[model samples]
Target: MVIKPKSLLKNKALNKWNLFWLISGPISIFMIINLLAVDTSTGAGISEMIQFSVRWAVPFVYLVIATSSVQILFPGPFSRWLMRNRKYIGLCFAVAMAWQALFIFIMSYFFHEYYYSDVYYFRDEIEGSIGYIFLPAMVLTSFNFGSKLLTPKQWKLLHTSGIYFLWAYPFSVYWWNLYYYENPVLIDYVFYWVGFVAFALRIVAWGKQRYELSKRIDPNYKTPIESKMLGGLFIIFGLLVSASGLYWQDLITSLFTCFSMVRRT
Candidate 1:
């Protein structure tokens, strides 16, 4: 039996449960390794584990946020796979966060003084608590049994808002890493651009869709030349914000702060 590569991709590559564990299993294993490897003797050790788990989680969330937009902008097999497994990808994120939550509990309970003094910030705590609340709700609704409990609109509302809330956590962290911190690491810049492109793709896709819909609704409808020129300018301006982070640092920092993730360690 000869298997064609293309046929294999369509027929069996990344089928649901396989894809889920394929991503989630490794993430879980790494968290376990961190548990064993890191010195659990101090709250500082637990904090490193929390940071490790967070790095694993953020990329999956970003992929979920960008999935649909990727399909819209560039229709292809890779994008289609992402669309199909968006739920599983999100579940992978949940698995990673679960590890972070476990470490958080260990810190808060066992190393109360260290947790309170070094790590605790009231605004960050509030945001993180809200994120945890949404996390389980999203995981529950990802399955049909829990989803059956909500109307279609209700389900949509929960997931949409939850995704944005999750995205904001890391986006703000990296935002500050680049602009607000004295000495930012290389990984910080990598994450900041990856996230910037993810959200930017969605915005560009939205504008494309709005134009297409307007044209379809009324054949006579024509976007003015001024609007077209303004669209180009908007793209350039957004790029400028990315390139010249220092100029807009203060305002962007203040705005993104205290919302979902006001402050990040």
Candidate 2:
């Protein structure tokens, strides 16, 4: 009996978990507020504050949670759901980004705070140069409507390129920080490094699958074991270097303070 997947999502426990993610907004908000409160009191740098609050403490976690949930809960049906519903996700991201623009505008104008103007520009230039390109490419490939418009080979190339862009952003950020002299922290570390893991996994899977592919060797592959191992080690080193960039003590201290007070109450 092929139990319909959507029917399974209706199970009480599964429904609760879905509701949990939905309701987690409040908890995330509170956590961010607490983080901001402590940072403000402690005089943390604006960039570090924003990075911790938005990138690390919130959006990245949300991204991982949402993607992981779709994969685990929906599986096969998830693909169809994503294809049918990706526009909604894109639209939501667009709307959130638009709201961020509005917020930045208000901050720069009404509040007379221009500190983040360059930060905004830096992030925009990087993401537009990279993330924007991939997202559109993925949207095009994953959409049945767009896929039909491109030849399979063309779509495959574009889709593969998009995946590449997705992986490249972290390295771009690393270099961007060096170029701009901006410091990154653990959250930034995790975001980029975790992404590297995904990228490395894909490469490993491809290489393993093509180990004896006599009729179909990847032109990109090198036959040398040393090169392959070196590439793997580079991925590990990147993660560690990125992780080393984090503001760990500050985060741990603030988090512990918050929990300790709660426990005392």
Candidate 3:
């Protein structure tokens, strides 16, 4: 039997609406499981469950933010598919985040004693609130009707800054944990660096596009080879950082599994 080519295997005809539900259905199911499985009897359990929900939501948020950057870096079938379905992906992220917010509200209602007293709440009031402020605006403008109300420049400004704001919340959280926590999780460190790389790539892409536009306006202006060199340097640095992060992640996972087994035995 002949193996199918990757190009042939790629689903170029995916409907965005169907794609949205396909991605969101599993997430909704996962949230349901978290809601059922979390021990809601204690404040600690509620805190753990809230973290679980937020952790699960983070990847989708990162994907929605990184979708355009990824497409810019690698133009291919997968990237094209991502570009086409990005709005749906953002919607999925919004749904997940909204559920996470609901869990937070429930925690505040039931475990007000701890929730109000915790330093986490105070920190969240600053960092998390700012991030949440962008969510509703971004989500509302994501639809055609809402987008139509804004000029093209206004829409672009809203989303460009909104994505960065959303990106910063998780990045800052993970970066802080990596620095201040005695024992930071490998995944958190990985995510922090991954967000950094994504942001860097986005800047590089934007700069390149802007430079091209400038060149078009001023034909006499020489293309800046130095800027290209800097971008190449950044890509190299990013790849090295990503490689090390993944390596450490695997090493830590293996050690943790071994330690768990030893404890069980």
Cα deviation of 49, candidate 3, in Å: 2.0
lDDT of 2 by residue, 41-118 (tens): 221333344344334222332342245334433457554454344344433333333333443444445444444544
Backbone clash pairs in model 1 (N, Cα, C under 3 Å; residues 3+ apart or in different chains), count = 1
For model 1, the superposed segments whose C-alpha errors exceed 4 Å read: 1-8, 11-13, 219-222, 250-265
State the lDDT at 167 in candidate 3. 83
lDDT of 3 by residue, 1-265 (tens): 7645545425443448777787778888988887788778877777876777677677777887777877877878777777878888788888778877887877788888878776355667787887788888888998888999899999999998988888888887886677545688888877887777767767767776787788899978776798778878977886775546534655776899999999999
Model 2 scores a C-alpha lDDT of 0.51
Candidate number with greatest TM-score? 1
Q: RMSD of each candidate?
A: 4.4, 13.1, 9.9
Residue 258 of model 3: what lDDT?
100
lDDT winner between 2 and 3, please give it.
3
In candidate 3, position 89 carries an lDDT of: 79
